[model samples]
Target: MPGTTPDPRSPHRGRAVRGMFASIAPRYDRLNRLLSMGLDQRWRAALVRSLPELVPGQRVLDLCAGTGDVAQALHGALPSGTVLHASDFCEEMLKRTPAKFEPGAAPRLTVGDAMALPYADQGFQAISVAFGLRNIESPQVGLAEMARVLAPGGRLLILEFSRPERKIFSAFYRFYFFRILPLMGRLLSGSEIDAYRYLPESVWAFPSPAEIGREMEQVGLVVREQRRFLMGAVVLHVADRVAR
Candidate 1:
């Protein structure tokens, strides 16, 4: 099972994913910066910018908020009174979030599962997940929970790794992604877990943007827009919660 891809529906998938992330927690931020050549930050900013205009005191949640990068961006972009929350199932990853912000400026960090978020219904005006959805045990269940917590008309911005469409570029992308990236990740993070190897596998296994849009619709969210970057190697899906 050294190179085996994790099945999202496997009963043990969540535990496996959590452990993998936990092992990489310390180097997660650094690895992200290196792996994406800092484009990850720009992608996260795009996700924040895609949010619909939110009123003061409205809430936003950054689900699967690894090290609170997106949550920090949300805090800076939102109005003064907006409440921002960052949640991740892996406590180790959440533990590193506070250092990213000045004393109290950090988004409220919570250790919670995406599939069964702790918040009440319709609580968030917006929710963002950056490159995290593919790690979920069941992305549909995760999206449903996101929809459940989103206030009517609230938006959900998903920035995730997507396949490149151009033939030549895609071949090069795969060579780097599958062959080079994982080796670099393993060497740089010094993690025993196959976290880097898992990355490409998860992204490759993830649903296409069109399929994801349909999944969003099934969960009461309407796809509003999609923007592709890095020659479609990454995508931002902007969706809104439909009133019941």
Candidate 2:
């Protein structure tokens, strides 16, 4: 059903989302590049660029890391002594992350739920989620969890899909997002679950950037900056954990 908002607390919704990603795991990276016209990586790079400088031995977490694209990018950008962690609930998607690196070079990969992350409090100096927050069963719970693990003054970056402000461009983008993109996804990934169809629907149902910023503030994070790409079709939110 078009315009239907997902019920985040539904148990069935979690299982369905997990199943959808697992089914598309094989061609996930390929489909992303094709569907986004290779702009995804650039968007991630922008996220990385927004990070605050870190001292040696400080840690970073890439939550809901599918195939470790953001983790790999962070690995290259971080100081030599810094550690990086990559986590996702789907093992099938996470298992592919190591192949993107040489022996012993990949970020520590963990199969864990975003809402109930398996980590200690104040553990990470920085955290990032790329196009994954909206997929969480409860994005607010996920944000709180992220805040719990973040050190005071730690930064969090969120790269996600957003609606364009320009009316004419938004209409064209919606036509492609809701209609054409899913067709390409089904053709390319051969996914029976219609994962790509879920993509636009999720985006449409997601909160606006300002709303998300307010949510962050409620969870002990302060919005620092927001950078939009693809003419507001995508947005990167930069925030910091409030010092306790």
Candidate 3:
């Protein structure tokens, strides 16, 4: 039962997520679009939609910024004058970032660990980590870092793959996710971690909505709402840093 997967005691259980992405960064975007059938763009747009609630001209942070997809999406979705800071630990992953941002938007890209963000306390109005938080080796520290960096009343938006609630859809998702995805990943990325194998594995290992809500609340982030999409196979978790 070793590879069967241990229960998720913390959100920071795997580094394979990072290693897998870095290894396949060259073809990451293409394969993502192909595998998700282009719905990933709409998912990022849904993540972008969360931006309007924040005050106009607010400061934004995109953690685990991998190629700046969320950052670029936010730049287009938010009001003008939003200060955007995008950060990722992998140099190879970040190398593809600038090209994704708007022409001349000049997003600040930093090579830094998510657990130890190099920024002043309470510095950002909104922080987003799309499909990236579950990969951190120390998610408690990473979540704490997000909390530490958020200004009073700032929002933390999280986008992640989730288990569908309905039994029928869950069965269908498992078939596609487990049986089909790994084969497609091998054909596309040529990754060694069985990258697609790790995808469903990580999603299964990730905390449920209630579990994540409790963890965020423990860190003083109030669980605001959860927008479930794709029959709950994906979730957008919205939390707000409490105003002091």
Q: Candidate 1 regions off by >4 Å?
A: 1-11
Q: For model 3, what is the error of residue 125's alpha carbon versus the real structure, in angstroms, after optimal superposition?
A: 0.2
Better of 2 and 3 by TM-score: 2
Clashes of each: 0, 0, 0
Full ranking by lDDT: 2, 1, 3
TM-score of 1: 0.95
lDDT of 2 by residue, 1-244 (tens): 1123234445447767777788888899998998999999999999999888899999999999988889988888999899999999988799999999889999998999999999999999999999999999889999999999999989999999988889999999999999999898878876677887888888888899999999999998999988888789999999999877
Candidate 1 C-alpha error for residue 126, in Å: 0.2
Clashing pairs in 3: none
Model 1 C-alpha lDDT per residue in residues 1-244, reported as the tens digit of each score: 2223345546458888887788888889989999999999999988888888888889999999988888888888898888889999999899898998999898888999999999999999999999888888889999999999999989999999989999999999999999999899879886777788888888888899999999999999999998999999999999999866
Better of 1 and 3 by TM-score: 1
lDDT of 1 at 180: 99
Q: What overall lDDT, based on C-alpha atoms, would model 3 receive against the true structure?
A: 0.82
- For candidate 2, the C-alpha RMSD (Å) to the true structure equals 3.1
